[model samples]
Target chain A: MTGVATLIRQPWLWAWVGALVVWLATAVFTGGKGSGEVLSAAMTFGAFFVIVALGQMFVITLGPGNVDLSIPACMTLAGTVAMKSMDGASAMIPVGLLLALVIGAGVGTLNYSLIRLLRIPPIIATLSSSFIFQSAAIWWNRGLRVKPPEALADFTTAKIAGVPVIALFVVVLAILGHVLLTRTIYGRGVVAIGQNMRAAHLAGVKVERIRAATYIMCATLAGLCGYLLAAFSGGAALNMGEEYLLSSIAVVVIGGTSVAGGFANVPGLWGASLFLFLLVTMLNTFGAGAGVRLVLTGLIIIGVIVAASGGKART
Target chain B: MSGRLSPRLLRSLLPPLSLAALLIAIFWLQPRTMSYFGLNLLLNLAIPIALATIAQMFILCVNELDLSIGGFVSLVACITATWLHDTPLLGIAALAGLIAAYAALGALIHLRNLPSIVVTLGMSFVWLGLAVLVLPTPGGNAPEYIRTLMTLKPAYIPFPIIASVVIALVVHVGLMRSAHGTVLRGAGGNPRSLECAGWSLLKIKMGMFALAGFFGVLSGMALVGLTTSADANIALRYTLLSIAGVILGGGEFVGGRVSPIGAVIGAITLALAGSFLSFLRLNPDWQIGAQGAILIIVLALRVLIGRAEARK
Candidate 1:
């Protein structure tokens, strides 16, 4: 628990180092400027996961076993609903965006009500809401693919200073998330509530409101991520949000955020997201198929959980 | 005496009673469903789901969650359609080993104090990977005998209904009315006390997980039997469906409280509810929403009733 040891114990550092190692290996393999493009591509794809993971990290920080299973559903809803509301018009982007966030907030409110009012477990409550939102997305689909407005599409693909604007947004969001969790009262309240809800409640923290906010934050970010993903892809597919569900959770876990809750690892999540995407690229570099890659992802998650064990929740 | 209508009593009765009411309502709306054959066809899918829910209930009884059930069932279906149909001994041995692996998972969860959710989530992928490797696609035939058994029809009763009844009865007796099951539940309710009383929480918890794996296998085989075919991705939805069934059946997250009969009843209710939605001019696509809406309403009612009782 010494300062140096604590620094060494930071798992996100290792994730980044692993990512660097992969990049170096790719450099060694390709032997040229290809690695840079690969790196940027990884970051660009990693941006989506990073955005989703930031929200997941907040919910994870809310307490042990707390997760927003409805994230993908929320994202799906936002993307499809936004498209429907926008009616394919480029000028209606802002309105569509607002509607998407509002839908996210609505799902968040449902989840909060289920957990708070009915005392349902966060996992189950969010999971139930995931079903609701998933169906809502399906109903909205109605034989239509969500075509994001032209401006939104341009914005998603637009580059500034040779860097993807979305990547910068992810970085800024990560910084804001880190600051919110570590440098702000509300953020501290979240950590406290996750650590020990009753204790935090007794300590005069607005435990309920903080928990509600984190879930809302998680869903809202998921909404934005969905919107961006739709715009980036130029249309929404039914399964577009499927990949985010486990990876976001995986990123938080890999980032060394304790699943037992009360711990926030926003910076670690950013690194972990980058690391995961890099790992995918590394696998692809080796000609690994999707099946093999999926297997490895599962194995790596299990390995990380086993390796990080400090006898959490044994009591 | 409040007519002895304690909220605890009503809460315990509500899930299955709601299911009964649902059945009656469905029948009232579509009277054709009241017949045994009609009910059988409607609830054919409920058999495996109920088994999985029963499996999930065992795990939840120990205050742990298994996100791997869906994957496990799909893997089982793959095995049933492929290896079990082709090579009985090897497939049977593999299944027993899988059950043992589940017990090992419980031991690991206890020994390492790992969160069951993450472990099971990770295990789910492994299971899915193995499943994809086995089937590689969605085409395999269930053994003829298995299909025959699944499709068995009695003159007066349906196969699924009878099977569900037995499942509910056996598990109810085993879990709710038996001493060993009480000890197992105690591991969740008061592990410290159970340990102090010289019972090994590790043993009970592992036993619970083993039972889950056992039921999970049964569900997988049942699903394959009902479908008469198997695919790599089949049964993936069972994970959430089973969890929903358990919760809808009066199960709690941390408490050791879970009802076996109610889980089966809940499963049937969910299946019927989905069918009812599609039957009532609702789009098949919107059945999921209908399920969610029903679940939330039931859970909210349970909460309100609990709060009222507290006030009393």
Candidate 2:
């Protein structure tokens, strides 16, 4: 019972409770689909958010005001690369994934240089890279709608033991992220640096190298999200990745992570992703237009950030 | 020899020098852009951008950012197209209300100790929603007076060039040259001292945000005036453009350092770059990448200069 209460007290617990309330509200209002079915459907999309938010959480946990603004562009570019490289060949899946990772690494390296070497602000550096990445995606696609590989699509769409394969895959990834954030030296180093950069540096932490690793990890995960979402969406499009940029940050904040950095809630991130996925889907079902839904999203982001940033500042 | 030239002088000279170099390149490659008409045509977009950049510079001077500037401008455009044309009094009242709301937002932000970016981002959605409510679609005409004002072309020089010069001078004089401007900047650079000096930081920030709103309205109105029509999404790109302009203009994120003249130069150079790309027949898709490259180069140069100063 104490364990249960403690779990409820966790920062991410509200997101889960809120998600459930929204799910119930949707079921009550729509009266069209069963709650279980809608939930599972929501999870299918939530998987993508989970993947992206995991990456965002790592970046956000890197410290105060450290944000990865290039997630959307990276996701879109990764999807484009995967779609272009695969060209409907299941045999080329590995190659496409490799290409996406390589490109993500290059972007990460550039971000590192811009922030560390050139001393450009993090927000500006990443935002500028977003423009560059989107341009690359546009040039690659050139308004062409290439079909995703048949075999990859089939695999992403498949079910396993009455559950979505994508959901299950994302769960595995979440577990991996949890382990990485808690049970590794790299993770500890990241947290220490975020908590107090000067202190960490004085204590012999490789602050620069760790910061570089955090960015690389973020871009690589975003790349992975792009490739996977491509398989789910049938094909990659130009604006597909746009939603993930802010939404990913929203998800991280909702997950109970301190906005000032040094801590992250891996499970909470997954929960928040699920919450946002369900919220948007439910809103769509109610025939609330895009503007209304966007307004609500903005409000939620403000509310969550205000709530987090208000109390989470380290003394 | 280097001691003869001050660091501040070099800093101020660099942006305009770069702009001159770019202009010379454009003149060499596409001589057609040198004429009054050609230059006016190419720089037609610079005025609104300069206004928006100045608005952003105001916020940056306080170590805050207003991500909603684009949305606020869009809302103003929608109003200018429909309400401003139909009922001028109501339109002016609405714009005034927006400025007051911006001041209130600043107070709320300061009171709550919240990050300005998220606050403004959320408000942006609210602005876009209101814009959609007002103008549901893309088609609305600006008032005749606005169109005429935007189209004023002198025979000797381009209207945009003259407009930009006036704007830079007016803003520079108001902020940098005025007494109250120091108090506003000091609110960012040294808040405790300013407070000790008996100024209300709240009032100063509110004034700053209100000024941002006022300029945002001008930018939106300028945009509609130039295009003669308005849409909610029309000026959304100005958000990023304005930020880039501020950065290119020799402003840092932390120090409350800014130059109105540099921002105008940055906006003009960016507009020219866009035109130059089109003139070169490069892929339209390449423009974003090229813009990013330019931003990176300029920022990288700034970094190099800082390092050189440190060495000196």
Candidate 3:
């Protein structure tokens, strides 16, 4: 009884409930046929969202003014750079992955430098830097579509007994992320800083260092997501990362993470990712047109946020 | 203190000074642009951008951002081209309704304590969806009146220049010089104090959002007039561009520090930056990147000026 009560009290529980309800609604609409397949599809797609949202959740946890607007550009640039370098060679996969991560780290460092050194706000700094990164991606490949290595592509698409291999790996990644946030000193520092920057500073936490690390970690995960996304989608496109920008922030917000910063929920990230993916699937299943789909998506997101904010007022 | 420069004065002067510098560079690269016809052609598209920047400035004045302005403007353009051209009454009603919706959205955001970024993010999708429904494949004709009004040439000055000057002065007077405007701005700088003064924070928020919507409507109409048609995604970039223009024109993210004149000048400078890049024979792919570099450079200049002021 206590376990159930505690679970119900959790902020992340709403996201899970919403996801389950949507999934059931979608299944009922389809008369229960291919329901299993739909769940599988949700997991596969939601895995990618979870990866990106995990990073975004941390950034949002840092404070109100902190967010990474360069995520989509970072994804595009990393994917473009890695794919072009790999050139479908199986032996070069490791090198490509390393390059992607390095690019992410570099972009993150530059983003922080603009904020710290030039005194530009993080929002404007990241946004301006993203334009430059996007231009670089366009100039580098000239919009060429290069195929991923066969082995890598197969691994990305591979399924194991009705479960995607990528989905399982990402679940493990989320577990590790949970541990990092809940159990690590670095994570505590992040929470403290978010609650009150001056208080954290007085507490002897290294504010700038933690901030830089968080940004770097976020960008690195974005890079990893980009590399995998390129493989999963068969190639990198200039506009491929466009939708992810909104989806990432949406997941973080809908996952019950506080927008004001200092609090985060890893479990909620998963539920929100699945909910978002399934929401789209359900809307599409309804045979709704593009305009209606968009409007509904917007409305549903607002609804979820409003519902979840009820808990916020009490705390 | 005698020889020291006020940071406030420097901030006000920077926008026009940068605009002049950009114009000089553009003229130096392409001397023919100094002519009236050339100047007119070069700045013709800047009118919509200036309007959008002003719209964004309103939202920024409240210390809140509007991610939906680009989508809102796009929807308006779609309405202007299709309905406004065919049935003027329907289009006017629709535009007015959108402004009302904007006010309502402000009220919801304020009353619910919802984050503006998230709400506007969702609203952007709604606008895009509505725009697509209105014009699925992007073909809509602008009204005759709109086209003529946009293209009207005055005696000695380019029409765009005259329009920009008018826009800046009017906004400056309404937002900077008026008494009621102070209360509106105070809502951004210190809402709690404004509330303590017996003003309704809800009303201030609604007024700000409605004003943003008004300018956004103008921006869309102007864009369709200049382009002669409308597409759902035509003004999607305006969201980011408007935000950038506001910042470039000496507007801070926090605090109610914004300059209407500076914002207009910044919009023009950005519009000219594209032309300047093309004149330099730079790769078209790198043009956007160049704009980013320009933003950083200008901001870096601000930092240097700030440091100098501090030293004094």
Q: List interface RMSDs for the candidates, in order.
A: 1.9, 2.7, 1.9
lDDT of 1 by residue, B17-77 (tens): 8898888888888889889889889889999999999999999999999888999999999
lDDT of 3 by residue, A226-312 (tens): 999999999889998898888999999999888889999899999999999898899999899999999998988888877777634
Root mean square deviation (Cα) for candidate 3: 1.5
**Model 1 regions more than 4 Å off:** A1-4, A21-33, A159-162, A310-313
Which candidate comes out best when scored by lDDT? 3
Cand. 1 Cα-lDDT = 0.86
DockQ of each: 0.61, 0.51, 0.66
User: Which residue pairs show collisions in model 3?
Assistant: none
Q: Per-residue alpha-carbon lDDT of model 2 for B66-96, expressed as tens digits? A: 7788888998999999999999999999999
Tell me the tens digit of each residue's lDDT in model 1 across A1-315.
599898887767766766787778777766755787787777788889998898898899888769999998899889888888887898899998898889888888888888998898898789888988899899888868867888888877777776788888889988888899889989999889888999999999998888888888889999988888988997877678987988888888888887778876777776777778887787788777766776776777787778777666565
Question: Which ten-residue region of model 1 chain B has the weakest summed lDDT?
Answer: B276-285
Model 1 chain A worst lDDT window (10 residues): A306-315
Please state the CAPRI-style docking class of candidate 2.
Answer: medium
B296 in model 3: Cα distance from truth in Å?
1.1
**Candidate that would win on DockQ:** 3
DockQ of 1: 0.61
For residues B187-209, write the lDDT of model 3, one tens digit per residue: 88988888899999889999999
Interface RMSD of 3: 1.9
The window of 10 residues in a row where model 2 chain B has the poorest summed lDDT is B4-13
Model 3 C-alpha lDDT versus the unseen true structure: 0.91
Number of the candidate with higher TM-score, 2 or 3: 3
